[model samples]
Target: MRQWNFRYEDGEWLASTVPPADDNLTAAVETLVVPFGENLQAVESYLESWGRMERENGFNYSLSTPGAVARRVSKESVEICDLYDQFEDTRIPEAEFISLLRALSTAMRRGT
Candidate 1:
């Protein structure tokens, strides 16, 4: 099975086969590993939780299209764009997106 490691690099998200070395970083960073598979339900659940968090925080956003891209729609902008922009890949695979959402959901659930 193939796995991809995603990390925040230079204010953007980058996916690569090899994990970044500790000596190459300045601060602590979390990485998500995505395994290839079908996980539609997981993706949906993550999106729902994500939307809920945004709504609770008073930000207007929407998950749209077959690609499932989440975008901010409100005039009052937030840091979501910067977060999304970190995803360097033009087309993010469903499994990868689900992994990201799962991490976010877990963080939210833990109240961290």
Candidate 2:
């Protein structure tokens, strides 16, 4: 399973899949970062793009933002609640959620 984390720092939103090893870790090994000022617009654009791409590719997944975690559910409406229960202490943000979708889209396009 792939896990992601996001943080707003130095006027930018940084995203990564690697979890911090300890409380002392400051900088994250980011996969991508969009300037903080562009967050709202970027998120909107990415969501629309993802929707169109999914339609064109006949993808059947749906994204759900409930509380802190972002969930990916299939047409059947199944979720990984069991997995989420394991990490009840963690809190994720909407930006990281959208970033995860973007990452998935990119990976799919690359056929990886």
Candidate 3:
């Protein structure tokens, strides 16, 4: 259910930032851990677990910065230092910002 790019010419699954030049995309995913998910998870987990109260407790991670709202993203799959971007606020493409509170609330309040 996830989309990714990779090269399989050699005996190993070579990782690269370059996209394929052909149209013969294959159904091969080198890793199940999603790239987007890594960013989201990093920010979400930090907000949910620890933060100075006002620093978003998972449900809300909106930090008013100089120009835009920045969020702390953390993930094991990615190098913690390189996972976050300063001006990477929720811009352009519309994507849902989910929180652990919302997910847990729904689960716990189900059938009530």
Candidate 4:
């Protein structure tokens, strides 16, 4: 199974399958950084916006800086694709994704 966890390290919160070894931004199957302050709120808002029926049904959510795009594959799953590198793409359950975000938010608060 894909391991999902988050940690507060070096003034940033990192959510990844495995915590990165160093600050060099090593490759991982899936990862996202939850920056402190207002950015954290933005991340939470993005999470909350998922799985909504009001919007267009097949819309893709793009994370520009990370070069990743996400789309809901089903009610329970989401697919993430790396625009720069196809090897990093993955599909995971929406619940797991939300859990990761929630953990990152909690970690950010604790780290602050």
Measured over all alpha carbons after superposition, the RMSD of each candidate to the real structure, in angstroms, is 12.5, 12.6, 13.6, 5.1
* Each prediction's number of clashing residue pairs: 1, 0, 4, 0
lDDT of 1 at 5: 46
**Model 1 vs truth, CA RMSD:** 12.5
lDDT of 2 by residue, 35-61 (tens): 223345455565785567557645344
Candidate 2 residues lying further than 4 Å off, grouped into runs, are: 18-32, 35-38, 57-112
Sequence-dependent TM-score of model 3: 0.18
lDDT of 2 at 105: 45
Clashing pairs in 3: 42-73, 42-74, 43-73, 47-58
The better candidate by lDDT, 3 or 4, is: 4
- C-alpha lDDT values of all predictions: 0.38, 0.40, 0.27, 0.52
Which lDDT tens digits does candidate 1 get at residues 13-111? 344333433321211112221211134455456577656867575545544433223444443332221223333223233344445555434433443
My TM-score estimates for the predictions, one after another, are 0.29, 0.35, 0.18, 0.61
Model 3: lDDT of residue 54? 33
Off-target runs (Cα >4 Å) in candidate 3 are: 1-50, 54-56, 71-112
Worst 10 residues of 3 by lDDT: 24-33
Query: What is the per-residue lDDT of model 4 for residues 28-61, given as tens digits with 9 covering 90 to 100?
Result: 2233442233366766676666635315555444
Error of 2 at 46 (Å): 0.8
Residue range with the least summed lDDT across 10 consecutive positions in model 2: 24-33
Write the number of the candidate with greater TM-score, choosing between 3 and 4: 4
Q: Which pairs of residues clash in candidate 4, taking residues 3 or more apart in a chain or in different chains?
A: none
